[model samples]
Structure formats: C-alpha cells, structure tokens
Target: MKRSVLKFGGSSVSDFSKIKDLADYLKSRINKNEQLIVVVSAMGKTTDDLLTSVSHLTANPNDKDLAMLLNTGEQQTISFLSLALNDLDVRTKPLTGYQAGIETRGHHLKSKISSIESDFLENLFESNDLLIVAGFQGFNEVGELTTLGRGGSDTTAVALAAALNCTCEIYTDVTGVFSTDPRIYSNAKRWEMISFEEMMEMSALGAGVLETRSVELANNHNIPIYLGKTLSDEKGTWIVPNDQMLERKAVTGVALDKEMAHVTITYPLDSKTFLTDLFYKLEGAEINIDMISQIQNQEGLQLSFTVKESEEKDLNYLFDVLRESYTNLYVKIETTYCKLSVIGAGMRDMTGVASKIFKTLLTSDIPFYQVTTSEISVSYVVDENYGEKAARLLCEAFDL
Candidate 1:
C-alpha cells in the first residue's frame, strides 16, 4: 500500500460545507487501503482576520501570546475536522505540530521544525485510520509555540512528509501549476513536471502557487510534491526529481519582482579591499542581497545589488550598519527598480537565448536598466514604472 500526505489549504477546508466535502474525500480515500496523512491550514481568512485584530489592539504584541492566538485558527480546523471524520465512521486523531513532536527553533513566529517525534503517529496508524495534522504552527525546543511565517501551513505539511518519508501532495484551487499565473496571463501553459531548482527560483521570484522554503525542504529530502486545484482537481503539477539534460527553449518561464529595491556601495576608488569590505558589512546587517552586479573602472569599482521592497524600510539602518562595520566605504540606496527573469534548463548551452530576450524587449521598446544571468536563469533589472508592461510583453513573447 502506498502512503501519501494530502494537505488541504484554507480555501479547500474553509467552512462547514467545505469541511464536509473534504471529510467525504477522506472517507472515500480511506477505503482504498492507502495510508493517508492529512494536513490543513486555518479556515478562510481566519489568520488574516486574527492578525488584523492584533494589529489594531497592540503595536508590539507579546510573541508567545500572538502565537497562541494565531494557532487557534488551525486548532479550530483540526478539532472540527476530527468531528466530521468521526461522523463518517472513521477513527482518527488530530495533532497540532507540537503535539506530534515537531520540535523547532523559532521562539514565537517563523519557527523551523527541527525534528518530528513520530511516536504518536506510529500508535495512531494501528487502526488503519487517517491522521489529520494541523499545519503552520509548531513548538520550539523550549516547548514554546511558534508559527512559521506566511507559508507556514505548506511548510508544516512538507515537514511532516519529510519526517515520515511519505508522498506529499499539496491541494490548491487550480488543476495544476500553470506556465504563469493564469490570472496574470491567459496564455500561460502548465508543466507536467519541473526540477526543484527551477521551482525554487520561481517561488523566490513571486510565484504564488508554492512557498520558497517548502520547496527547499522537499528538495533536500528528495520528496515529490503535487500541486492542483481542489475545486476541480482532476490533475495538478507534480514536482519530481530529474537529472535530465536536454536543450530547452529560449525561456521556460518569465518571473517578475515588483517589490524590488537596489543598493550600491562605493569604497575607496582603488582598493579591492573596498568590495570585500562592503559585502561583509551587508552580511553583518543581515540584509538579504540578490543579483549583485559589479563593475571595475578607473574610478572605484561600483558594486550594485537588489533587495525586496519589504526590506527597503530598513534601508537607513544598514547605513549605520555599514559605518560600524567598514567605517570607510560610501553607500547609497535606490528603490525605483524592478527585476525580470527568464529561466530554462538550456540557457547555459543555448546560443541566442539572451539575444532573443533582448530582442523581445527591444521590439517592445523597453530598455533594461541592468541584466544578470546564471546557468539556468537570466534576470534583467528595469525601471519600476515599466515593470508590469515588461512582464506582460515577456509573457506574450513566448505565448506563455
């Protein structure tokens, strides 16, 4: 018998009616002699609503209290789901991340699961019943409750599957993963499978279907993940391991980062010491850097890099950070930037992939402010004003 983990999103099990539908799916699946492990997120908008209430009440809420409150969303879902399963004559138990021995490192919010006990899970499976585990929230080593950030639920599911070495499938609202977000581009195609590296880049570049961290965990553990719409989930995208080497099209996907900002630092005009010093300064500040571009000229070499806009608010803090670290380099920050990416397996060996991208943008009359490329991806930085137009034109270029 095959063991699989099926995780339902908030929208999939958002309410009483939706919960009933899921319960039915579980009951029927249980009849297949297939060992089932279930993970679910909080009901629709419950986490968001709870956070809104918190923001209104306190500027700095207690982390422990906040986790406790945030966890109630999934708690309610788990208990309700257990009740519905009981109604269908299936014996089952629902365990929160912590109760299932999912120990983590986070104090309150954004805790990473360190290990899963699996003791209770071993006992619960004797009845050949389904196990429903709450997603997102877990406990630290100190036994304090903590929530994984935005994609907590997905992380929860992936973690459990990794710990148990079970087949994990993520259920969303679409049939499977599309070439691009269908809502954004009507021509976006769907891939039957994609490598872990490509998917991780996509998630980092703002692909909303899956979370970046979850993909990392799944990739590390060599686990397969399937993404499909639960509403009409006939088929979804299955993420599988691949070492296949084939020449891919000029571009497999186009990714955009709207909330992007760039920062440039100049050290003494002539020292190799300056570049090294600036990177160390930024690292000490804990500001994640992306697409670091460097240029060497008679005047000091110019070092440019990108960071998300969400981190832009703390830009000035880095100035103090740089001063404390290097005490010698001059720094400047720029926020009016956007990043566009073209990813494919064949980008490394392909002759004119970069040329095609440039021509596509040139024909659209959009000029790239900066361009960065890796073995499997090419990224271009442009003015934020044309970010949307650039993404649309790029998507339409390949009929994606």
Candidate 2:
C-alpha cells in the first residue's frame, strides 16, 4: 500500500465549490490499496475575521482564550472537507490536532510540536482510506489549546509527513517556488528544483510559500517536499537535499521582506550596562533581532537592528522600561524600510555575489541603511518604496 501526506492551504479550500473540487480530485488519486492523509487550513479570511472580532471585544484577549477561539477555524475546514469527501463515497475520518495525538510545548499563541503519535493514525488507516486532519494547532502539556504562528500550517504538514515517513505535497495559490515573488517582479522564473538549505534561507528571509520551521523539519528528516498550485496539473517545484539538486547556481532566488521595523538607539558611552540590559529584556520577550550593528561614536554607543513590525508594541514597552535606567537614551523606530535578500547553496564556493548585489543597487541610485551576509545569502535594508525596484535590478543582474 502507498501512503503519503497532502496539505491544502487556505486559498485552495476557500469555499464550498473549491472544497467539492478538492474532494473530487482526491477521490481520483486514492487507489484501492492506498491510504492518504490530508491536512487543511481555515477557509479564506476566516482566521483574520476571527481576530478582528476579538479586537472589537478587547484589545488584549487572554492568550489561552485567543488560542481556543482561533483553533475553531481549522476545525471547521477539516469537518467541511470530510463531509465533501464522504458525499463522494470516500471513507474519510476527520481529526483535529489534539485528536490526532499531536503534542506541543511553549506559549499559547505560538507553540511548537513536540511529538506525534503516528501509531494512532496508522490504526485509523485500517478502516479508512483517508484521514482529514486540522493544521496549525495542537494541545500543550497543560492541556490548553495552542496555535502555531503564521504559516504554521506548513509546519504541521511537514511534521506529519516526517512522522509518517512519507513524502509531502503542498498545494497553494502559487504554481511553485520562483526566482522571486511574481507579484513584485513580473519576470520571475519558477524553479524546477531547490535545495532544502536554499529553501530554508529563502523562507526565513521572507519567501511566503513555505514556513522556515517546516523547511527546517523536512531538511532534518531528509523528507522531500513538493509545492504547486491547487487543482492544477502543472509540474511543481521539488525541495530536496543539496546532493540531489541537478544544478547549483551562485544566486538561486531573491526575497523581499516588507514587514520590518528598523530600530536605532543611542546611549551614553558611560552606561556600560545599557547594551546588556536591553538585549536581556528582548531575549526574555522572545523578539527576534536581525541585521544588528553597533558603533562607538562621539555622541554615544549607537546600536541598530531590524525586527518584525508586528512586535512594535512590545518594543515600545521594552524601551519605556529601559528609559528609567538611562535617562539620556535616544531611540528611533522606523517602519518604512524593507529587507531584500538573495540566497543559494552554490554561494558557499562563490565570491563577488555580495559585490554584485551592492553594485546593482548603488548604480540604480537606491539607498540602503544596513547590510548583512551569511555564507549563502546577502541581505540589504532599503527604503520600502524602492524595494521592488531593488529586487528587480538584483534579479536581472544575477540572471535569476
């Protein structure tokens, strides 16, 4: 018997018609001797609408309560999809994260999967040809309903595939991974195959197709991932190990992250503990800081970093507390900047990749505020208004 996991994103299961279409497609794929596991996200805009409703009730709803309410979105999808499949004479069983024995740990709003009880799922396959499971949520050790963060449905799908020891197929709006976001660069080219390491870097730098955590999990287990448009016959991109890649390019793709907040702080040079105290508080809050730079100038010790704009509120409160100790502290938070990055596995043995990026942007008269690099990637922070132009220029320069 053949077993595999399939995941459909929100855009793919947005309505009753799409659900019906997906059910028909799945029915055709299931063989008499095969068992399939399907994972699904909430209907289009359902999770966003739920959050908006909670905002109307209170600015700060209890974390546990919020998780409890948000989980209903995916549960709705699993049930609806199950009903559709059942109508077509398919033996389907719908299971929520908790029901499927997915245990999670950590915060209520952004929990991580600890382990999955695959034996329970295998037993269900004995009596059913398909199991529809909810994505993005699982129960914590304390037995409270918890949600994974944004793009978490991808993580759930990959994790389940890892546990089941099978390949994963992810269906979304995009046909496959591209050289860059097609919406930003109309000439972006779709990739036939990508290395797991390259995919992880692109995801973390801001490619929305797959979650970074999901790519990391798949890479760790050597699981192959397929990404393609839903209900389409087009050949999609396959993510595999570096050794499995057919060709390695110095720059495989360009990624643009617009949801960034640039923070620049100037503290008195005499305050030796300023940097230590500030970072300590940020670490405690679990706020990720990136592209950090520190300089000692006549004015003071200047520090600059980038963080997700969604954490602006928490950052405001953190700086307020720091103000008490350092009365001369000066802080500026700018949300009008974006990060553009280029990533590839072949860059490990390549040089001038960074030079090409810098020259491309400079010659185009684009202004960048900060820069950072890894062995496989180089990122730059530029004005949000010029982000698209910068990405396009770099894509052209690298023939991406």
In candidate 1, what are the lDDT values of residues 130-208, reduced to their tens digit?
A: 8888889888877788888777788878887887788889997777766666776777889877877788878777676
List candidate 1 segments past 4 Å from native: 62-65, 231-233, 244-250, 264-287, 294-303, 312-336
Tens digit of per-residue lDDT, candidate 2, span 1-400: 7888999999999999999999999998884566789999999989999999999999879889999999999999999999999999999999999998889988788788999999999999888999999999999987889998888889999999999999999999999999999998899999999999999999989888999999999999999999999999899999998789877899999999999899999887665688889989998777889999999877779889999898898899899999998889999999999999989888888888888888888899999988898989999999999999999998899997
lDDT computed for candidate 1: 0.79
Q: Which regions of candidate 2 deviate over 4 angstroms?
A: 269-272, 297-299, 324-326
Global local distance difference test of model 2: 0.91
C-alpha lDDT score of every prediction, in listed order = 0.79, 0.91
